[model samples]
Target: MFASITGADKELLSCITRLPSFFWEGNWAEEIHLTICPIPSLQDGNDLTVTRDNTGCRIEYRLPVHLFRGLGLLKEHAEEKNFFINQKMYIPEIGIMTDVSRNSVPSPEFLQSLLDRMALMGLNCLILYMEDVYEIEGEPRFGYMRGGYTREQLRSIDDYAAGYGIRIVASIQVLGHMEKVLRFPEYAGLRDSSSCLLAGSEETEQFICKMLSSIGSCLRSRQIIVGMDETHGLGEGRYRVLNGRRPPIEIYLEHLNRVHALAGRYGLNIAFYSDMLFKYGSEKHTYLDPHMQLDEKTKELIPSDAQLIYWDYYSREASLLNDMLACHRSIGPTVYAGPLLSVSSFCVQYEATWKTAGPALMAVKRQKIPMVYGCLWHDDGAECSDWLGLPGMQYYAEHAYTEGVVDPGSLDSRFLACTGLDAGWFRDAALLDEIPCINPENRWPPNPCKYILWQDPLEGLYDADIRGLSLDLHYRRTAQLLRRDLEEAGENGAFLRVPLALAEVLEIKSALSGALSWHYREHDMTALQQDAAALSELYVRVKKLRRLHREQWMSSCSPFGWSRLDLRYGGLLARLETASDRLQDYLEGRLSELPELAVPRYTLDRCGDLLGNGIWKVYDKSVSLSDG
Candidate 1:
C-alpha cells in the first residue's frame, strides 16, 4: 500500500512518523496509501480525506505544498479513528504572536521547535512581536545589548518556518510602546510621549520607514502588524511642544495614514491594534464594552486596506465580543479577532484564558469572521515559558477547524495526540495561582509565582497579607506535591523544574520569614541562630534553583533575558547571606542592632503599579526601609 506513495505524499508521511505519539505507537510501519494533490484556492487550501479498505487505508490530502504538515496531522488523526472524514478549517488564518519585545528573545533553534509544533497543530501563521528586537541599519543604539535578532538569523528562521507552511509575519511598534527606542539619545528628540513616537514628525516617519524596510528584508511574509496600541499620551510630548496642542485623534490619524503608506511601499498589508481608535472616540475609553462608540469621522479616517485587530484577553462575555466585532466591521472589511493565550503573567492562567478566549472564538465563529489569531504577549519581563502557552494555542486551533465535528470530551486526547504533553499537567501547573492562601481578587493579571518568589525577605510585604494559613506548611505541602508530579512526568519533567524550584524556594523563604518574625517578637537569640543557619542552607538551595532555571531558560530561549532572573535571585541570595551574617554577629555581641529587621508588621494594598514593582522597589538600593 505504501509502495505507490511518492513526492509530497511520502514527505507528509515522513513528517507524520516523526511525531512522538506516532513513534510510540509504532504505527508508521503499517501499510498505507497516501496521495497528495495541490488544488487552486480550496478556501485556505488545507483539507484532508481518509478512506479505508481490507488491506490498508488510502489517504487523499488536497492542500498547498506549504501546508503538507497540517495534512499529515489530519491523516494521523483520521487513521486513529479508523474512519474516513473530511476536515477543513473555518478560520482561514490560524496565527500566533510570540512577543520578543518583553525581554525574553527565543533562540533560533527554539524558534524552529516552535514552528514545528505550530505545524503539527495545523497553524498557518507565526508573528514575532519585535518592538525593538531586530537590528536596524544606521541605528546603533536600537535594540542595543538586548539580544535582538540579526538579519541572517531572522532569514534563517523565516525559511525554516516556511518549510513547515507557516508564514512569519513581523509585529513591530510603529507608534507607541517605543520606550526602549526612545531611551537612546538619538531617538529621544523624536518622542511623542515617554513610550510613544512623535507622530507627524518627518524624523519619526524616516525611522519607521527604515525599521519596516529592515523587517521586510528579513521576514518572508507580506503581512505586517504596525503596532499603535495603548499610546496613552500620543501627541502630548514633543509633538505638543513643537506644534501647538492638536486633537489627539487628528494626530493619530495623520500618523496612521503616513505609516500605512510607508508599509504599502514595501508591498506589505498593514494591520494595527484597534484600541486607540475606540479609546479616543468614546468617553469610557474601552474597546470591548458595548457602549464603545466611534465617531464617523474617526471611522472614516481608517484606510481601506488597513486591517484592524480587536484584541481582548480580559472579557469573557460573548456579547461584548459580538459588539466589538460589529464596531470593527464599521471600520474596515479586514478585521481580525485576537484572543490571549494567558502567558503574559508569570504562570499561565489556563482557566481564565480558556473562559475568555473560548467565548471570544465562539463569537467570532458566530459572526463569521474570516480570520482569528491568539496572542501570547510577554508583558513586563517574560517570566512565563513559551511552552506553557501551547495548550491555549491548541485550544484555538481545535476550535477553528473542528469545533462541531470533535467532541469536547475527546479534546484532551486530540491535544495529547497533537502535542506530546498531558492536558491535565498543563491545567495543574496553572494551579500555582490558585494556592488557597492567596487572595483571589487581588491576583488580577495573576502572577503568584513571581510575586511569591520575589517578596522581600525582611519586609514580607506580600506574604504578610495571608489571612489564616501557615505559609511554611502550605508551601511545603505544595512543593512535595509538585515533586511527585515531576517524578511522574519522566522525560517531560525538565521544564517542570522551574515551578518545582520556585515552590521549594517559596517554602524555604516562608519558613525563614516565619522564624524571623518569631525572633523579632520574642527577642530570642537562640531562635535567631537557628534561623541564620537555615538561611545559609536555603541560600545554597537558591543557587541550585538558579541553575535549574538557567537550564530551563536556555532550553527554549536566548541567554539575554536570563539576567533578569539572575538579578532577582542573586539579590535574594545576597540579602539572605547579609541578614544571616548580621544575625550571627548580633548573637556574638559584635553588632549593636539590625535596623532593617526591626520592622513592625504591616500589610500594603496597591503596592506599586506593575505586578512585582512593589517588592522590587523594596529591594532597590536607593529606597531605604524607612522610606518604604
Candidate 2:
C-alpha cells in the first residue's frame, strides 16, 4: 500500500519504512494505510469504513464487541509500526495526557489555572481523572470518590480545557485502588476480597457490571482511561477476606473484560495500562504475577477494540519505551504513550524536574501515537509552586507542538530576574562557574524541570574568587540545615514543641554567624568584604528569635483557639520565617557587596570554591559531593 504512493505521497510513506517487516510483501509499499487486520474474523461483519462528508471529515469503524479480547496481538501491531518508523523522518507530536485525579482534588479555579498554564505551553490534551476524586457516601458500594467538588465544577473545567483546543479525556481507576470503597462495610460483597472472582460469591460479577454502567453514565468523553496500573496488592491485606484463592491478575482480567464490555455499550473507546498483561513489560514493577506473561491465554482474553496506554517515567533507559511501543504495536494500531513531568512529593532538585523526561518526550513525539498525556505527579497537592518552572513547561509544550531548539541563556535570565530572593539564590548558582543554570528562573523553558547535574568539576577559575566561593559553601550549608529543621518542626507537632528543636535551631544560627565572620575577615586582603558586623548581628537576632519560640511552645491551640496541629505549625513557621529573613539579609548584604562569581551554566557546585581550592580533598566526600 505504501509503494503505490510516489513523490509527496511516498514522503508520508517513507517516514515509517523501519516498521516491522512481518507484514512486508511485494506490494508492501503500495498500501498507504498501515492498518492491521488480524488473521481471525473481524467479528459481527464489522468493516473499516470511511467517509468525507462536507462538514469536516470522519472515519468510522464498526469494530467487534470482543475486540478487547486479544491484547497481545494488539500490542504487536503497535510495536511493528514503531520499528518501521525508527529509520525514517517523522513529525514528533509529543503529547502529555493526564486527568486531575481526586487524590489531589483540584477545583475549577485550580483546574482553570492549570489548563491556562498548559495551553500556554502548547499542550494538546488533558484527561479528567475524575473517578476517585469524587465518591458518594453509600449505595454504589464498589467504587468511591474522595473530593468535595460538585459535578458542575468538574464539567466547567472540562469545558474550559476543551475551549483551548485541548481534548479532555476522562480516566477511571476501574479494577483496583478501590480502598476507599472497601474501607466502608456496605460494599463488602462486591470486592474480590479472597481472590477467586470474589471467591464463594456470584453476586460480585453482576455488581461490577452495574458499577461500570453507573461510571459510564457520568463520563461522556469518546475516550476513557482505565487505570489498571497498580493491582498487585489487591486482595492481599484484609482483602484476603475475599480473593484468597484467586490470584490478582485472574480477578483483574475479569474486571477488565467487564469494563471493556461496558465501554462498548456506552459508545466509548477504551484504553488501559499495559503493565498488568505481560511480565517483562514497561512498568513491570507494578505487576504482581511474574508469570502473567503475554502468552496466548492472556492475549486471547483481551478485546482488540481496546487501546493500551503505556506509561514510562524512568528516564535512565529508553529500552522500556521501545519495548512497550513494540509490544503495543504487535496488538493493534492505537496506543497511548505518556511520560511523567513532575511529582511534587519528592524534593528532587529543581534542575531534574519534569524536563528530565525530554528524551522520552522526544521518542513519543517521533512515534505519533493516537493519544499523549503529561503527568504532574503532585502527590502532596501543592496548589502553587515556584513559577520559575513555568517557562520550562511552556517550552516543552512548544517544542512538542513545533520541533525546534530555544536559546537557554535568554530563558534562564528572564526567569531569574522575575523570581523572588528565595529563588534567586539557586538561580545565582548557575552563574557561579559550577552548575550551568539554563533557565535560572524557569521562564520560557521547553520543559519546566529541565536540568542536569554533572560529576566532573567545571573549568575556569581564579584564586581570589575561589576563596569567596569557599565562604559561600559554609553559608549554603547552614541555610540548608536551618531549612530542614524548620520543615520538620512544621510537619509534626511533637518534633517542634521540644527542647531539642529549639537547641538545634539556635546552634545552627550561631554556626552561621561564626562562618560569616571568617568570610568577612578575607575582605581585609582585597577590600572585597562588606561590614561583617551586619551578619553577626543578624545571627544574634535569629538566636533570640528561637529563644522566644521555645518560651511560647505549647502542644494545643487552647490558648490560641485554633487546632493543636495548626497552632503548633503556625508557631514553627513563624520562627522559621524570622530566621530565614535574617539569613537572607546577611546573604543579600554579602552578594550585593561581592562580585558575582562565574559558574558553569548548567552544573551545581554545592561546595562553592572550597572543593575547587582542594579544601574538600581532606573533608568527607559525601558532604562535599552533595554540596557540589
Candidate 3:
C-alpha cells in the first residue's frame, strides 16, 4: 500500500539512500519489490497501506489535481523553473525487456536470469511492450502471432522482479498506434479509415477499453504506459471508410478520453508520449511552445490529469525541456519530464550526450519535477541488445540518476572487470567484447577520440556462421590501431577516440554477420566452413598485429578487455536446453527416428550440449535491478 502515505511526496528522499533501502528490503526474501519509474517527488504522497499477507506491495494514489487545475500555471509562470531535478544525483533505473514482437516470449527461467542481471546493475524495472508480442483482437501483433501473457506467467515476472525491487511496467499500444490490430482481418472493420482510428463505434471503444482495464487490473503495477506515439497513419482515409470524415486528432482524442476514463477505474496512473500534441508544429501544437505557452486548442485537448512524458533523446537543445518546466509550473505542479537515454551515439562517438543532457536534467530538477525516466528506445530489441545491453545501459543509468559522472570507456572497463567479463573476451567473444566494437555514428567531430574510429581493415576474414568471431576480430583490430594513434592525440587523450572506433567496429561486424545469415542458411556447412576458415585466418593475423604493436593498441584503446558472454548467453543457453529436449525425443525414439540428415545432427547435438552445460556453469551470473 505505497500510496497510503500522506506527505510522502515531500520526503526529499535522496537517490543515494533510497537505493540502499530498496536493496535491503529486497534482500529480506519475504517481500520482493522494485521501483520501476522515477520516484518523482516524495512529498504530498498519500498514505500507503500494505498487509503482511506474503504477497507483494499493493499501491494506490489519487490524482492531486483535475484536468485544468494547472491551466493557470500554463499561461503566467511557465518559464521560471528548470525541467530536470538533481541531475548530478539522479541514477536512473534502466531495464532491458525483451520485445517479443518478432519472436516467442522468453520462458520463466530466461526471465529470471534477465531479472537477476538487471538487479545486479541497479535496474529497477522491466517494461514488456505487450502489444507487439502477444496476440490480441483488434491489436494483431505484426510479424508474429497475436497471443497474450498468461496470468500466472505475468504474476511470476511480477513476483520475481519484486524480490529484486524492480517494478514491471506493462506497455500497451493504444489509440493511433494500433496499426497492427487495424490491419488484422478480425479488426479491419472496426478501424475508422477516414480517421485511421478504432473509435468510430461503441464496439471498438469497448474492445480497446477492455484491454486497458484487463491488463491494468492484472499487471499489479500502479503505472501503465499507453503507447500513443507514431500515429502517422491516422486520418489517411482509413476512417473515411467508417465515418463520413474526421481529423486524426479528433479520433485520437476520443480514444484517449475513453482510455483515460477506464484507467482511473482500476487505480492506475496512465503515461503517454507527448508527440501528437507537438506533431503539428509549435504554432499548430501550442502545447509544445518551448515557452510553455499553450494555445486554446491545445488546452482543450490535453487531459488535466494525464501524465505527459516529453521524450527528447537526440537533441542537445534544452529549449524544449526549459519550456516544459515553465509551462508546467504556471499550470500546476503535475508535469513530468524524462530524457531518452541513448548509449549508442555516446558509445561510438565517445562523446557524452549526457554532457548536453546533464544541464537539461538539472533544469528539470530545479523546476521541482518529481522524477525523470531514461528511455531505451530499442527498435529491434534483440539486435539492440548488443548495442546498449545491460552493462552499457547500466553505466548510463548510473550516471543519469546519480551525481557521479563516468567516462563511457571507464564504465565499460569497470563493468567488464567487475563482471569477470574483461578477462573472458580473449577466451571467447563476450558481450563485453562488443563494447569496443560499437560503431556509434559520430555527430560530433574535429576530435577523433571524442568519437570512435572506423578504418578500412588492413586485412581480415569474414564469417557468417560462427557468432562471436566477427565481433572478436573487430575489437582486436580496432584496438590495435586506436592504441597507436592515441599517443599523438593529446588533450582529448584516448578517451575521445577509443570508444567511437570500437563502437564502429562492433556495428560493422554485427551487420556483416546478420547479412550473411539472412542471405545464406547457416546449415550450409560448406559455406559456413569457408567463412569460418577465412575468419579464423583473419583472427590469427589480428592477434599477431596486436602482439606486434601492443604498445600502440593499448595506448589508443587504453580501456580494453573481457567478455560478458554470460549475459545474453543465458538466453541462448535456455534455447539450447529446450532444443536438447527435442533431441531427447530423438534419443528416446519418442518421435523422429532420424535426425534431419541434411542438418548436422552431430554438430547440432554438440552445440546444444555445449550451451546447456555452459548455462549451468554460469547460472548465478544474472542481474535484476539497479540499486535505485
- The CA lDDT of each predicted structure is 0.70, 0.40, 0.43
Candidate 2, residues 1-628, lDDT tens digits: the string is 3422222234223422422232242342342332322223223443222222222212222221111111112222322322211011122222344334423344456455545445433354666564445433245443333443445655565666554445566666666655555567665665654222242244654554454554455444677777776566655644475335556666566667777776777677778877666543324444322233466776677787788766665443456555556666665554544434334321123344343455555555556664555554533222112222344444345344333343333344323222111223333221222223223332222111111110111111122222233333433443454445445434321222222232333233323322333343444422212323333443454455444433332221112212322433344345345434543554566433322213222212223422222221111221123342
C-alpha displacement of 95 in model 2, angstroms?
4.9
lDDT of model 3 at position 101: 35
Clashing residue pairs found in predicted model 1: none
**Clashes per model (N, Cα, C within 3 A):** 0, 94, 114
Per-residue alpha-carbon lDDT of model 1 for 330-413, expressed as tens digits?
Answer: 778544646554443556777667667777778777777777888887765687788777777777777777645333335676
Error at 104, model 3, angstroms: 7.1
- Residue 43: error of model 1 in Å? 12
Candidate 3 local lDDT, residue 16:
16
Rank the candidate models, highest lDDT first: 1, 3, 2
Candidate 3: regions farther than 4 A off: 1-107, 120-123, 135-148, 193-196, 284-292, 324-360, 386-388, 396-628
Give me the displacement of residue 231 in model 1, in angstroms. Answer: 1.0
Q: Is candidate 1 or candidate 3 better by lDDT?
A: 1
lDDT of 1 at 516: 76
Clashes of 2: 94
Worst 10 residues of 3 by lDDT: 66-75
Question: Could you tell me which 10 consecutive residues in candidate 2 have the lowest summed lDDT?
Answer: 448-457
